[model samples]
Target: MTEQQDIQLTFEEIVCACDNNIDWVVSVIEEEIISVHGKPQQASYSGFQLSRIRRAHRISRDFEASVPATALILQLLDELETLRKGG
Candidate 1:
């Protein structure tokens, strides 16, 4: 059987996947919405981190949410998801 490897994405790929710019990505990073594995230019993220970015991006774009607001929203959503999962 083949083992599955986690996909690691670069900073640019995350920005592209979220259809956002570097500044916006930086904003989310500053707000601690997601964590990176290296320096900004060479930053790397897991697929799960990318999901968080997408969710934050959507909230920011759709709700005109401030970085802090987006962070809080993500936290609440994560907690809700955990509860739903009976975790």
Candidate 2:
């Protein structure tokens, strides 16, 4: 029970925050780039997922990369974070 623990961003929120289309975000979801909570009829994202999505979105936009390429970059970044933690 802490900050960002239960902060669920709905599809509308995500679209607004990311300034992207619902269909595009839905494509990300369909690709399993990140998972969300809430009913099937009404999904919501967490801060962690939002951060990850932002990273991928940034990389995609900055480098004009494809979805799979963005995913690869995100995976590498996560690995870099893990290594930074001395784990």
Q: Which candidate is the best by lDDT?
A: 1
Off by over 4 Å in 1: none
Q: Could you give candidate 2's per-residue lDDT for residues 1-87 as a string of tens digits?
A: 766445777777777655756766766666667765644228767887787777767887899887777777877887999999998
Q: Could you tell me how far off, in angstroms, the CA of residue 25 lies in candidate 1 after the best superposition? A: 0.3
lDDT of 1 by residue, 11-86 (tens): 8899897675888888888888997655765877888888889989999989999889999998999899999999
* Candidate 2 deviant stretches above 4 angstroms: 1-5, 37-41
Model 1: lDDT of residue 49: 86
Q: In model 2, what lDDT does residue 64 have?
A: 88
At residue 61, candidate 2 shows an lDDT of 83
Task: Give the Cα error of residue 80 in candidate 1, in Å.
Answer: 1.2
